[model samples]
Target: MKRRSLIAAAIAAPAALAAPRVARAQAQHNWKLVTSVPRGLPGPGVSALRWAERITQMSGGEIRVQVFGAGELVAPFGTQEAVESGTAEAYHGSGSWFSGRDIAHSFFTAAPFGLTFDEMHAWMYYGGGQELLNEFTNDRNLQIFIGGGSGVQTAGWFKNEVKSLDDLKGVNFRAAGLYGEVLRKVGVNPVSIPPGEIFAALQSGTLDGAEWVGPANDLAFGFENVAGYMYAPSPVEIYGGIEFGINLDAWQALTDAQRTMVEAVSEAEANRSSADTFHANLQAYEKLNAAPDLVIDTFPDDVWQALKDASREVIDEVKDTSDFHRRFVEAYYAYARKSTEYKRYYDTPFLVERESFFS
Candidate 1:
């Protein structure tokens, strides 16, 4: 009782869930966590297992986290809802998957050309993005972490080669967040499905094309198996970041020692996820390219321009209602614009630095 009340003093809305739950904790000794990702997706689940294992070992069997691979327990998209409602102790997922919760979530997952993984970490941890996201979570009896990212992603796989907007029109695709909105403008029938189903969706012919994470994840989803025309420079996505959630009651019920372990392990999971994607995605790309029939393509200049224009329209609509989102876009682009301008002096113009040996 003392521990419960004391812990509740520091938390804002969590006290509601913590107080009643902790009084009963003396009756139960360990925790069980449910996650949504499949066994191997190069995202949150893989990162979490490594850290969760360490916590299990250190706790000497007192603390336990049981990871439920996708569809093993709740449906993949149901993770956050499960956590909030106490069906699970935690959730491993991406903001992109739950953008339906709040448009503000889209900012965390990565806006089009928003921040890269490291840049987002910088902004989330030091630049107030974390505080903002938690503000949203805390309202719902949930607690969370930055949960790292899968970095950038390929545009998608396509049946017919896309030379221009003409190719994009009437195309049925798998996409998420504001990207879906942008796709609609370009005449794509964009659908949102959980990551676990992308490959099956593609395989069954329900989807004309799809893109999931970077190369590594795409490969894991068997993207290479169906690659017809692989496209790049996804005008709709720059970075795809995953988000982790902990039930507020479950988090607060832990002892101080347990609290430290949870925080440390979650942070470690974030780091591992980022690093794993960096190296693994490189290998996945090789597999994609190794196939003789695979046709790799980059969007022509006009196509890129058209997509960019459509994306801007989507951004403006998102900004109109979300001051938080608007501010984020403003701050992010502020940095990007400055970065682009500075790079123009030395990076954009390429004669291979004629004065160098190569010249």
Candidate 2:
């Protein structure tokens, strides 16, 4: 009887020890991620898909992410709400689209005449931008991550040449966030059109002009087919940022290891997205530049000056919104001013010399 009892106890002890191990092994997460752009729409679209793949691979299948592009599961603008409602676990898109909720969101996307991709990242990763971002999103029950960016987008595709600042007046243009507001100050009528409908709007004359992204994406969308003039170096969107806003409940449920993996993959993908956009834009720009009857031009010096002046007025309105807005604006411009000072001596001169040497 004693030997039988001892055998039973030994067997139960092993089973108890193995239960936690089995549970740990089976701790899997299957998440649904939605994006604000159609699947395979280039740049942000590509980055969203890649982000899922990397997380699945990196987690060794412990975590799997399924991506739904714009309108696949919800409207492009509905992504944030979907995540908050648990209809989707996460969302990938530009923060600017949601600036109506908090004006500071525009900074998360791209500030008017603001930081470049590298400069934005410097502010986000080092200059306490992320901390403030967390605070801002926390109120809305979300956690934010800066995943990617489209660098130095072109001004846009215009049906007619913008010969003067007055030419911009009353033009129904598709621009977002502070860009749209700044353009408003300059007399352009800003319209909000989804990515999928931009071409149709332009073709039907519903929109006089539109700025989607830089060359790679704009070329793919065939903006040139409708608009004859493509302008460059948009002051408003120096860097078009892409971000992931995860439902706070879902984010908090992640294990420490899983959270680390997500952040690591996101940060790594940011670098990849920038590099991919640069190379693709370079190749696409060459193609667009050679396209027959397409006038690739830059905004005139006077127009550029007017834009800068309007941008100041728009930014001032934002700064008066709240303490948070003031902080974000201050931090952003501090870095921008510092970067400009250094780049004037470093990058700007080198680029001028390089162009001269090549010419």
Candidate 3:
């Protein structure tokens, strides 16, 4: 009897070893993704749609996403709330839009005199910035993933060129987040308006000037028709990037592979969107530069100086807000300091040399 049992166990072990392995079945997820911009609008708008597409495609039907443009499902600024309340599974937009809830959110999106695209991307992905974000968003029941960016936005579209620092005083301008605060410090009355209404506002003289994304988007909206001057080097928005805020409960439900797919797709889209914006901006800029009526220029030196001073004051005030703000500010500047050191030696010199060589 013992011999027979041993022989049977040996046969079963051989059979098990020879059997083919089966892959684990992944659960299907259907999500609604809301955006803060109109559907198909260039830059962040189109990038949001593409982000949804890539996730759906890469998942091989395991994860499906449906996207809703701003106001289609919820108001543009309601994106974070929608995801937090589980009204939507995810949201795509700038985190700075919701900075009123926590000033720390601005660093993840746009901060006055903030890091550049490469610097911001590195800070988030490798410099422990995302961990800080996780700490902030966990309380709101949200998770963040950096998705896309607008690289170096235009200064603004002005009805007339700002000739002096005094010109900005009492001017009603459309700006957002920390940008608005900095402008207010410089004596400009900043107004927060939705993107859809900006053109109408500019046309009707409600806004003396407005800062939108950059050349690609500004030209698309036909700001040149109402605003004669388009300025460069938006001080507050060196690199404004978009983020994906997912419902924490929904995120937790995702399989490990599915979660990884979401992150991988987001990183890929972030780099792609930045590159796409730069290319589109260059092409659109060339066209706008040739326009007979539009004038493209930079802010006068005095105005730039005033803006820089105001930016410093605003950022300093934010540091005194709370311990969280202090920590976030410190972390941001630490990385900025390290990054600047490298840029000075390599990027700045190379850029200057290239310009000199070309000219």
Error of 1 at 288 (Å): 1.8
Candidate 1 ranges beyond 4 A from true positions: 1-29, 39-43, 60-62, 192-207, 255-257, 328-359
Candidate 2's error at 249, in angstroms? 2.5
Which runs of model 2 end up more than 4 angstroms from their true locations? Answer: 1-26, 204-206
Model 3: per-residue Cα lDDT over 1-359, one tens digit each: 34333322332232322112223144678899999888877777888888889888877766789999989999988999999999999999887888888888777767776889998889887797877777677667887888767777888888877889888899999998888898898899999897889999999999999998888888888999999988888888877788888887787676556676787788998899889888998999998999999988888999889988998898888899988878888898888889989999999999999999999
* Higher-ranked by lDDT: 1 or 2: 2
Q: For model 1, give the 10-residue run with minimal summed lDDT.
A: 10-19
What lDDT tens digits, residue by residue, belong to model 2 across residues 1-359? 34333322432332322234445467777889999877876677889889999999887787889999989999978998898788999899888888888888778666877888888888888877777777677666777889778889888899999999989999999987788888888899999877789999999999999998899889889999999999988888887888888877676665556777787788998899889999999999999989999999899888888899998998888889899888878878888999999999999999999999999
Question: What is the TM-score (0 to 1) of candidate 2?
Answer: 0.89
User: Best by lDDT, which number?
Assistant: 2
Question: What is the C-alpha lDDT profile of model 1 across 51-83, one tens digit per residue?
Answer: 567777775555777777877778867988998
- Clashes by residue pair, model 1: none
Q: Could you give the candidate ranking by lDDT, starting with the highest?
A: 2, 3, 1
Score every model by TM-score: 0.80, 0.89, 0.89
